[model samples]
Target: MSQLNRVAWIVTVGSCLVAALILVLSGYTGYAGVTLAVAIAAAINLF
Candidate 1:
């Protein structure tokens, strides 16, 4: 894969992992909003 593609993949995975961690730590509340935002960001990067 190209460098840009690798970077995008990393960002998407990292963001999702962080969001999941945040959600888990917060008892599945509060930062639920971040999950959506991160998913949108990842989807945008796909193009």
Candidate 2:
């Protein structure tokens, strides 16, 4: 695999995890936690 493919895989897996975390948090805390996790993950991947 190439560097871009590797990064894409990371992004895809990260997105799935973020979504699941958000969904789980949605049932308890709310959208805020999910949104925060997604934002944090996105920020991490950006750099």
Q: Which candidate leads in lDDT?
A: 1
lDDT (0-100) at residue 25 of candidate 1?
84
Model 1 lDDT per residue over 1-47, tens place: 58889687778867786887778787885566667567767766656
Stretches of candidate 1 exceeding 4 Å from the true structure: 29-47
Model 1 worst lDDT window (10 residues): 29-38
RMSD of 1: 3.3
After TM-score superposition, what is the CA distance of residue 13 in candidate 2 from its true location, in Å?
Answer: 0.3
Model 2 per-residue lDDT tens digits across residues 8-45: 85776577567767677668556656655665665565
TM-score of each: 0.57, 0.54
Best by TM-score: 1
TM-score of 1: 0.57
